[model samples]
Target: MPTSEFDLIYRYFSSLGAGPAVDLSVGDDCAILRLEPNERLATSVDTMVEGVHFPEDMFPEDIGFRAVSVAASDLAAMGARPIGMTVALTLPEADEFWINTFSQGIAQAVSEYRLPLVGGDTTRGPLTISVQVMGALPADKALLREGAQVGDLVYVSGTLGDAAGALAFLNGEWHPEPDAAEFLLQRFHRPRARVELGRELLGKATSAIDISDGLLADAGHIAAASGVSIDIECGRVPLSSALNSHPDSESKLKWALSGGDDYELCLTLPEEVPTPEGCTRIGRVTKGQGVKVDQDIDFTAGYQHF
Candidate 1:
């Protein structure tokens, strides 16, 4: 007997949908969510296709977690508190082992991000995962990309380029020490979304964005929206020791500048605002257009799917 979609949902995903904000979860036509009167809703969706967003051979668990994390990153950028999420999973076939393992990943993300699985769909097709995350933001305060002003200091949470370095290692571009390789690979597979830090920056940050498309490109987004130029001091960008172990200065810097998938928040704060822990001051917003890096290295404006 072949398993049905409803069976799959009941067997693996039904229990993952319990949260304070979720009035109703799986096994229903629609999930019900509640928000406080002082709160506004924030939502975003992200899609990941096999062999594009992730390697075809990547573990099912990692794929599940990555999908949720990537979608939730958008909420982090808005300084919102996660409420619930939905996953639309398309699979070539219903392999029980794969489904079980993938569900574990989703469960892990749900616990880590405090985001419950609300409702979703399953269909037969090429392997793809689309995650839609919903969050709640204070009615009077929410981060935007258009508030950066000249003289605001630019900062980024956590290290950059590790995921890009991991990609390079996977592609056989270069091989580092075993320890470095392990660290980089994990960084790529399980990039942390800066949700807490984003919430902490609520009233202090002038503008913000997550570094999904690399520092230079995402910073350009803030610049374009805020009508200012961002000047990045290449020397000040943070890099992990694992990425620094690559032994190529130019490559390291390029990855830091143009490598995507870091998922760290890039934000602008007024000079008087106290910097948060684990954040490094990288540059400043100025009167101009686009982004500028004070380095001679050559690179494109981050990853493009077109």
Candidate 2:
């Protein structure tokens, strides 16, 4: 007998939906949620296609975790507190082993992010995962991309280019020491979403964006939205020791500048505001348009799907 969709939900996803805000979760037509007074909901969705968003041989557990984390990153960018999430998963076949392994990852994220799995759909077709994350924010308070002003210092949370470096290692571009290889691969497999840091920045940051599309491109978003130019001191972009193990400085810098999927936060703070720990000041907002980099490196706008 084949496993039914209902069976999959009951066995794998049913228990992952319990949370403080979830009134109704899996097994219901619609999940109900409660919001605090004076709080508004912030929601965003992200889709990960089998080959397009991840490598063909990527682990199922990593895929499940990555899908949820990437979706949650949008909430982080907006300085929202995660409340719940939904997953719409499509698979070519209902492989029990694969589903079980993937569900472990989902369970892990649900626990770590404190984001309950509300409701979603499972169907037959190409393998794809679409995750929608919902967060709560104080009314009238959100870190937006349009609030950056001239002279604000630009900052980014955490190191950049580790995921891109992991890709390089996977493609056999270059080999690093065992420790570096392990670090880079782990960075790719389980990228952290800066949720707490984002919340801490709500009042201090003038403008912010998550670095999913590389620094140059994501920073360009703030510039365009805020109608200001951003000048980046390429020498100041922080790199992890693992990434620095790569022999080619130019390639590492290119990955740092143009490599999408870092999942870090890029924000602009006023000159008077103190820089937060674990974040590096990379540049400043200037009176102009678009983004300008001090280094002479070849790169494009960012990742694009067409």
Candidate 3:
């Protein structure tokens, strides 16, 4: 690890911020950005702690990839396109090789998402990664949790519970076939943010939220914020083939409903609008408050910091 922060930034971080939207990048005290006319800026910050968020022994590259991907999920929920991001990294003790691999992973996500690295800080401390993402959308187009109306249909993108299934494998509570294991493990490490679908849902979805805190709890957030109730049909929630293959159907369903870190979007739309291509209709918004699932199940809402 390099002893000087300036040297580390120049070598590993500066080049990641070289896109056109960034007027000032890593060398400066703060990032200077240019937002297009009629566009609104959207910013979100996420922090991942060692052991709690990820295993300490996990690959350095995966840590970097998951950090950026999870942070960008917020933008997807808001129907905003990412412009740039700043990573504030805390290191217990820097390792040159680890930093290189981690930066490679971050660079990969930055390239794929078209998000430039802007400016941030690096300091010595418990292992943690905080990423602040900036995105933009046309004025009045950003999706909000408060927009869902009564009778709106609820939807979720992609399969749920695969990531939770992966955690089960890691915890030795579940054993899966090799192919299924690979798919589930990949889901845990690399979550795909639904940026394109979110953009497509703009002006269409009445309300939206990213499923980071489990499907039920996140849906409740929308219900509470919008002053309406949401009812999800457990039978209708989509599960991956990997989850379906597992023998314990009940456990799989529980994981799908209450397990966090799915990073998929749960949205509500008017009944007249056709369901988007990749999303599955799960339930509907009602006149009451709180979230209710059709099946009788008991579990915590999702991952909680406390």
Candidate 4:
């Protein structure tokens, strides 16, 4: 489709609210923002495309949630609490119904994270969503992936592999109860960023990375960034009942290791600090390179984007 002209702006993008920090809203030539004293701004943007990030037939709400969650994950990695957002969408057609549902999901996320939608753009193209998020934290407290010390303990929040299990269900390996199925699919569709935990750990953590990729891949990120080795105890990964009830825990563990899109935070904490509520210590940062799980531990390979 050719570029959409200016008239469609009001048709789709005009109704969004311009909440706090928005000195000038959309429809203006510029935007202005104000930050509280001593607050440091943290920003992240992520783009998702149909077929690459999600299924073509996925409900619009899920699409909206996933898009924003991806960006929120980045903020969480930096231990920032969200402040506001701008969304840019490109679609193949002007589907009012889809847009409405999508906006509802975005609104739900905004409320959930206590952030507001300040401004953005809407235009014509293949289905794509680009969300830019702004967050803030005290300058001394922001988390960094490079802050890990050799003796720090590694931890992750929530369960792993449920999203991968949902993909299996989507491919028809087996059927599950609707609510049970929904839980797994929800992880894939609208992963929850560990923002609350991130904020809680800001000054306490040595290093952190959000688990957008599977455990090994993301753990590897922490290892590489911090210049340390990570030894994860495979037995410690928290599996949702979804993964526990599966016929094979080994396969589930493997999937947990390699699957992407978990969106949970994988962090390094100085061993002296007790693990926070809701965080599981899955490993320790070491002196070598890469990630190591027990040799006997095994599961499906992590997400292979290629």
Candidate 5:
């Protein structure tokens, strides 16, 4: 075992973060970061717990990668560009191989997002990882959840339900074809934050939220925040081939509606504005409150952390 916590940090987590956005990194009590002129900082945190958030036996590297990616998804929702992150890791004890693999996963996400690992803490406890991501965007350009207007059209980036499908498979609800199984599994393990697409919507999207919960639930958030009702066209919800291959149509649709963890962005745009590339128009904001779907689809709940 490592002699001390500092030794563990130095050996595994220290070198994973290095970049211009960070003025001072892991060795300090606090990370010093620099922001360009006219830039506003955005920060969000997400914590993953073993056996609750993920399967206890999942690969250590996958757990690390997911911790960073899920945290960055919040920044993506606000149309911010990620610059730095701090990971507070808890473990039962120091396992050299586990630490190395986990750090490698974090390094991969850090490199892909161009974020520096700034600073965090490590302690002995039940396995848990909390990642805090910091990002920045031009002043007054964030896509907030409170900006939707009655006339705005609703759109979603990429397909939904794949992650949910993976969850179903894990729970032994259904089995998909071999190819679809792989695709769904990957979608759950490595969800993209849609950073570029979010940036593209900076001035275009009226309101935005990343789909950490099910579509209906997250959309309801925008509706509730903006004080406007959202009506979704269930037929228009996009599904991947993997999701489409599910044996039961209603079950598949339910997964898309309430299964959560998709990590895609759902936003509202002006009706006259053209839909951004890589996004699909699925609904519209209306004059009432709460979210209503077109189909008889009964599922309306999302993942809850209570």
Candidate 6:
């Protein structure tokens, strides 16, 4: 806990700008992000803190990466390509070492998504980081979670429940990982934004929302927003191998159906839309409200944030 300022930067923020997309990075007053002049900008912001959004002792580096990824995922949900980002830091103290590690993680994430740091603010607080990412898309082609009709196919990207399972492991509910426990653990901590997938779905998906919450809960958002009914098939849920192998798969499934924070994309598309390789066909859209799984799994009563 008693870390020095320089060491914090060296450990946490130093490895940033290692990737090709990072034209400029931390230590500068502002970073310059490059993009085609004609591209439109799509942007979003997310903030996390020591205790409010994560464990108090969560690594500062993971916190940094996640802060950016969450906001970027919103852009991805809209079918935009990432362009750049601004990071705002409110810390309890000026721990340079922590900031450095955080910067590296942010840069690492940006490397994956191709957005570099463009600008930001630093301040004093209880270890809070807010990131706003800027992305680009055609003038009028962002995907909204409101185009599903009575017969669209409900699709989801990537497997669900890994983050929730990781959280369970963190809370001591279980242990996981034969070959990549740390990787899965990092998923909950530093999840990647599905920008590429979102971009691919631009012309195909009728409706879409990044699944920050469990599939059921997020699909419900689309249902409510679009004034349609969603049928989320429990059997069709794209669960990770680790999740299916766990002893408490049912409860884990429930968690995936209710718990948020996965940050993947859930979409509704015409049966004709050529879904990308990894996307799963989970269920259907019907003539009513609420979400269910083949008429048997009721998700209308899923998690509610009070």
TM-score comparison, 2 vs 5, better candidate: 2
Model 2 TM-score relative to the real fold = 0.96
Q: TM-score, each model?
A: 0.97, 0.96, 0.95, 0.92, 0.95, 0.85
On a 0 to 100 scale, what is the lDDT of residue 207 in model 6? 91
**Span of ten consecutive residues with least summed lDDT in model 3:** 297-306
- After superposition, the stretches of candidate 3 with alpha carbons farther than 4 Å from their true spots are 1-5, 300-306
**Residue-wise lDDT of candidate 2 within 56-137, one digit each (tens)?**
8989999999899999899999999999999999889888889999999999999988999999888889999999999999
* lDDT for predicted candidate 3 compared with the true structure: 0.88
Tens digit of lDDT per residue, candidate 5, span 53-149?
Answer: 8888888888888888899999989999888999988898788788888888898898878878989888889999999999999987899999999
lDDT of 4 by residue, 4-37 (tens): 5444444454555456666665667655667778
Q: Report how far off residue 254 is in candidate 3 (Å).
A: 0.6
Angstrom error of the Cα, residue 181, model 2: value is 1.1
lDDT for model 2 comes to: 0.90
Off by over 4 Å in 4: 1-16, 296-302
Total clashing pairs in model 5: 0
